[model samples]
Target chain A: MRCWERPLIEIIRLSVNGDSHEIGVPSHYTLLETLRYVLGLTGSKQGCDKGDCGACTVLLDGLPTLSCILPVQEAIGRQVTTIEGLADPDGPHALQDALDLTGGAQCGFCTPGILMSAAALLNVNSSPTRQEIREALSGNLCRCTGYTKIYEAVELAARALREQRPPAEVLRS
Target chain B: MLRLHPYEYHRPRELEAALELLKEHAGDVMPIAGGTDLVPNMKHRLFAPGHLVALKGLPELHGIVERQGEIVLGAAESLSSLADHHLVRSHLPSLARAAGAIAHPMIRNQATLGGNICLDTRCTYYNQTFFWREALGFCLKKDGDVCHVVRGGTRCVAAHSADTPPILMALGAKVDTASPEGVRSVELDEFFIADGIWNTQRKPDEIVTRLRVPLPSPGLRTSYQKLRERRSVDFPLLSLALAVGLDGDDRVESIALVVAALGAKPRRIGGLETLAKGERLHDELIEEIARQAYRQSNPLDNIIVDIEWRRAMVPVFVRRAIREALARP
Candidate 1:
């Protein structure tokens, strides 16, 4: 270990979901804690608190990352997109609607993180194969659905995004 | 919810400042690149550093550049980026594969190459909650003295579980490190020591800043194969990395077979050079190589699976890795 004397608390600014937030937190607080406890955004779940479970997955600079292990200071100036940021002015994103339609979320504990991961995937590749979707969501675990419905939901959402059709309209068909 | 032990955190924007801080706080501060490994260990009370020097956003330790005939990888480069980098994919696909296969996608996003290379050895006895370890007598790696893995043993036998070191060693990569003293480069093969307690040769104040992989010559082939409990998120029970260079006549010219996760350090088996060099690779020769790897592997009962079974799987994984590397055009 190196020797240094630094203040325990630091004021860090973050750009989260298009909103800039300035918060004073201890350096030890992870981004997950800042988002859930301090900033009052509880969309991301803390399943493992380690990097094992993807329940705390969030998009940092458009890339899905685990916020549990990321220090708040590391995310100071980065763009953080949580599950709460997934919805638009209209309603839930297409992926959320697809999950609702397909009953992809059973316990819903891991839903937010899975949604963030899949959203990041769709944001990059609007139309992805089933295998690609599975690969993209490999980090996210769904113990309840057995991952069948989640895979179907991602496929449905991909089609909805590709066809520029509302998720409700796609589900109706 | 497991909480980290509180400590002063210093985010140094400059590499020089980070090194200086490390030099000043040589015995009290730990450098953190991605907290994927350190934070979890902190939760387990494996370490309680007084201060943490954050290495994030240090321009010196961030980038993958192809210089001259080598791929210069910044130690701070995330595993995700390294896996997706075109240079790594084209020139060192085995490294890319190993990078992608580590932990999971989110972990790969936060974990860096240097962090993985410097990842702490693991044992079931050592990686538990503080209360859990307290209830049971602690092992030699941490608080208690007796080694739980090797009963009555004098030292720690925690297995090295990182997925990159063996592959890097197979590629004959070198790492450049920085300290207040100066910067020095060491071959990856010489970086790791055999002891589980004092795993690497890195000093307290030194920080691994970059890894340089020499560009493969023509006819060079490499592959990395890892066997774990699950495909999603588990450390490798056994991993084999094979790098073979075939002569124009299709005979093995140069070869390196490194088996990891079975011991404290990844070791390159010497039997391959003795048996397969300058010879056309055949099923019998491959079998002999696998047998040698199996004999060299020394798995302990400290990991998830049965020790005997993990030991037996060494040859199987090595055969597969060798076949895969040879099959690639």
Candidate 2:
């Protein structure tokens, strides 16, 4: 048996969605597992636990990262945002409401990851072109193949956010 | 969900400390920059290192600068930043394109240049889950000894599926590394050897610091073309990087074509200067160069793609790459 094969535990600090928490996690745990299992933040879905599917996407220090591949220790001192962080006490995020209203999420298994990816994009480019939206969401895989509606939802959400109106109002417009 | 093997994680604040950790653990510890490659491999049981030394945030390994006629790219710089940087975009657009074309947006945000260049050789047989490989009896790349890609063969033939190394090789780049012993630099051309188990010249204890790409000549035009099933997230089925320097009169002064994703090391097509020098990129000359690329590339069934289909794409992609380069202003 090798020395490194032995399991070890360490206490680490993580900042997620404007909150800070100290938790003990196994040294080998990925951010996705730490979120879903240890911290009970299961909004970051784990799909293709490797780097293939973007279902494990999270916003790390304002950048969308594949949490399944990210070692939890690396998240120290960085802000981690999952799908749960997208909305406040008010309601679902504009993107989420837009996705629901547009019927963009068929299975909902891939929604959390896709929302995180889209949030990262909408944060930077509030008014993204269709091509830019497609490029940004390319990492995420939605098996339902409802990309047309998903793209439409993103377009609709962008207009609502830019106009400072609800996605429902923007959808009607 | 695939689980990572039990291990210890070390995050060193200094490069010296990181090197010391790597030296102390030696073969037991693996340096993890992006974790975009190593993490998945670990989950797949391709690697089970006892310890991982994080190199993502070392100050010494982060930055991009134009230094003395070269573009110095910090090994830890993310692919997203590198692809979007003005210096890389204006000076080495092909490299920028290649960097942008890697994986996808979320991955580019985390993956680094060093990780991409040092990416592991991949194969359908080797990249599978542990049970999948065990049911078939493992191949030469991992626990088993027999070579499944080339049955009865003694060597491992996993494909080098990186998008940027071939471009860096064509651009005459140099790799810089640091260790407890000190720092060392090597030409990117000699950095890779013909072995799929571990292909790079980097020692186990050394950490890649940065890459220095000599600035392109005024008339030099370079382009990269990738053949993947999808536009995002898929590794290259076939990738080609072409660079041609033309005299003021539009006559070829020098040319280089490097094709990858076929073998352990990216194959640089030879005799290109002999055939292309002092000639215009006419239909005949282009066809001849494409033929040279076709003759040199022999893609196997390492990837699930058809071997013959991948081989047929060598010339087609080469011609398209040349046309793309020629079209660039």
Predicted structure with the largest DockQ when compared to the true one = 2
lDDT for each of the candidates? 0.88, 0.93
- In model 1, the Cα lDDT at residue B247 comes to 88
**Which residue pairs come into collision in candidate 1?**
A1-B26, A1-B28, A1-B29, A2-B25, A2-B26, A2-B29, A3-B25, A3-B26
The 10-residue segment with the lowest total lDDT in model 2 chain B: B145-154
| Candidate 2 lDDT over residue span A33-58, tens digit each | 99999999988898899988899999
TM-score of chain B of 1: 0.98
What's model 1's lDDT at B229?
A: 84
Candidate 2: tens digits of C-alpha lDDT, residues B1-329 = 89999898989999989999999988788999999999999999988889899998799999899999999999999999999999999999999999999999989999999999899999999999999999988999999988888979888899999999999999999999998899999998899999988999988888899999998999999999999999999999999999899999999998989999999999999999999899999999999999999999988889998989899999999889889899999
lDDT, residue B202, model 1: 91
Please state the CAPRI-style docking class of candidate 2: high
lDDT of 1 by residue, B142-222 (tens): 889988788799877888899999989998999999988999999999999988886899987888999999999889989
> Where does candidate 2 stray beyond 4 Å?
A1-6
Cα lDDT tens digits, model 1, A116-164, are 9999899899888888888888888877855989989999989998989
